[model samples]
Target: MLKKRNFPAVDLIALEREACRRSLATFAQRAWHVLEPATPLRWGWALSAMCDHLQAVSRGEITRLLMNVPPGTMKSLLTGVIFPAWEWGPAGKPEKRFLSTAHMQTLAIRDNLKCRRLIQLEWFQSRWPVQLQDDNNAKLRFENTATGFREAMAFTSMTGARGDRVLLDDPLSAADGNSDAALLAAELAFLETLPTRINNDHSAIIVVMQRLHERDTSGLILSKGLPYTHLCLPMRFEPDRRCETNIGFRDPRIKDGELLFPERFPEAQVAELERTLGSYATAGQLQQRPVPRGGGLFKREWFGTIPALPVGCRFVRGWDLAATEDAEAAATAGVLMAQAPDGRFIVADVARAQLGPMGVERLMRATAEQDRAAHGAVRGSFPQDPGQAGKAQAQHLLRHVLTGFDYHFSPESGDKETRALPLAAQAEAGNVFLLEGPWNAQFLDEIALFPMGKWKDQVDAASRAFTELTTKRQASSSSGTLRGFF
Candidate 1:
């Protein structure tokens, strides 16, 4: 006699043989007539949403549907394989004009073949022989009762062909999104191709893909705008909901003390995602969060609590210059101010814009001189561009505009973000204060995201100036000099 199966659960250990199963024989692919394990309510809700989305497309209730979910949760299984089978009158009438693409042309062809295989199963051979307009190369066609003929193709070589319903499943493929441009380019080409291949404006485009990275096409789509229901099912979406595909509120798998998390995801694996990715990335790729750009590095919440600079602190300025207002570049300057007795610094400003090198020099001198007037005295700093010409220019500025002022040439190394993170952390944690003035708005906004690994000019200059002063002060005190030179 067969052993009794546990309610709301299955033995995944027995299913371990087919981690990436394609055949319709898997309980997930063929029928949901029985309560299958997965997020059943959510899965059903999503399917219901999908059908509404599809029907909306058929009647123009909506235009495009973008579905992104993490791996091992059957994105294509629901949207591509099973959804299409059900649409084709449930028992394989070979319905829907579905074009499921991966990053590669061949992968698109494979999905095309998978759908054909399901229809060709012995139980549904009436949908077999898949008809031959072009079988070997990835073009498929079938008859639908109301919609007439339907077709599917890989991204490559689909010129003037048309479709009544187009399902672009998993376009910017996760396999190639991270480390391959050619793969991403291929996917974009496919996406562009789908809209063009649509027979009319009445056609609907359904996109299903795994969320890969911040700059991937999925990221681009999510950044800009796309009309679709974005669904994310993490390992712990529900404990009592055994069927991850169900996703219902009353999920039988989710309970107060269920051990679903360990069974679904190892602690080590989840930890890696948390450590390696940013907050936006964690939400988008791992947690399947929508509109991720909304949660940028510097939220508006971090703005209001900015403190005022203390009195009697002299200021020195550091500038990393930019030459032009051309579309690609930004000019930058950093302001480093310090109090006397304690020798502690409070970074007061950042000025970034598009300006010429000479214009930047002039602006730096003016800003420094003006700041000094208020603080008794201050100095101006430069990157010591490592040339006789640059050194002479620095000496010339000290003599002319900055008479009776000090100037120092400093050089920078390593990454800007790396250097600035320690300083930025201090600022964010309320350890650093800014000189309260009109410039605060521009300064705070520019410094917020401060660029990644490259030497962000303004941030670099500020960090380098701090390093130089701190190093000199420590050296002087050790050598028993007059002051801890700030």
Candidate 2:
């Protein structure tokens, strides 16, 4: 016979290679071993989600794809390295051209090298005939024997090049995300330049990144209602924010606050990450949102609501006034708060209005009268500006409007962020309580948006009230502290 050819063994080998070639996830698992045999693979649902979407792109099902996943999720390893190699070899699409760019050219080159190394492996070569051309095996650009090529470039260097598949991996660094010019440049490259670089109508573009800012490339695309299959996987599952993309793909997890990729990042690891990244970075990089999931500085869960004020509570009605009644102008706000016997802070009532100075004066006088009737012996706290006009305004209000009230005027010492610290600390420690009122929603909403909110009048008043309640008494000096100045 012809040397007794082992056809059964040959057929089994072909089947194994064909399975890897058909599924990106399967190929990745095998490729992971080839690339890093020391560390075992910890498979998760997120990997499956990404592979399914990428496979769709290869099959011409999704033309534009955007994936916003948490950092350290192996997004780069999967999309940048293995997907392209799998496509060229097992998928038998070696003629497909690829243009890959990142925030830095070095990162693009890093993945490009990984992909190049992957295709040349004996295991990969034993199954697929995809071989790199001897003429062009450089770092920035490389070509396969079948005429397909992978070109690595920086987001800033995307000039006169075209590709059938364009991939942008973290186009804006966290530091650069804060710069307007950097954001605009990255966005323009994605929106204006990259679209034109696609070789034909069948070309697909994929963007993978962790969100860094509200105006990041992903945010811009979503805001503009672009035709993209967006897959957002945050570190924790938020039931209300569960994403449903255009391709009828919905987040499968039903429970709120469920961990994503718990196999890789367990509960303890996530807690460590949250502690290490701080609130802001944890929110943006891990939670896939620019703002904290709880709140910026204040968490909504911190303030427990009480049916009524506790006994022996000393009260202060803090005011943050506006100069005009314009609809766009900040609303004049007054917050009445009390320091309880147990040293906790309790917010009682809020009076907010958009009015002129005279109207504000009337409202203030009426509110003071209401405070006197409801709560016994409540003191007033008003903010004084720096210049003579601010002093004059304070004197006018004290003499004419808030006559006979025990009040003091104090100029704000530092920035809004600094002033809000005392209240934020109390809120975080669960020492802040909200007395049941109709204004609870507005107060909590404004507090949650603190420093970042467009209108901070409510927060300013609340911070002042908390400060007034917590300030300690010092011995009187010659400078005469502005305490109860008649």
Best by lDDT: 2
> How well is each residue in 206-282 modelled by candidate 2, as lDDT tens digits?
99999887678888788789988999999999988998876667888988889999999999999999999888778
**What value does the lDDT take at residue 252 in candidate 2?**
89
Q: Which 10-residue window in model 2 sums to the lowest lDDT?
A: 473-482
User: What is candidate 1's lDDT per residue for 18-45, written digit by digit as tens?
Assistant: 3212233332333543223364422433
Q: Go through the candidates in order and give the C-alpha RMSD of each one to the true structure.
A: 9.9, 6.9
The alpha-carbon deviation from the true structure for residue 271 of candidate 1, after best TM-score superposition, in angstroms, is: 6.7
User: Which runs in model 1 stand beyond 4 Å of their true positions?
Assistant: 1-59, 80-110, 126-197, 209-281, 289-307, 311-345, 354-416, 424-430, 437-486
- What overall lDDT goes with each candidate model? 0.51, 0.86
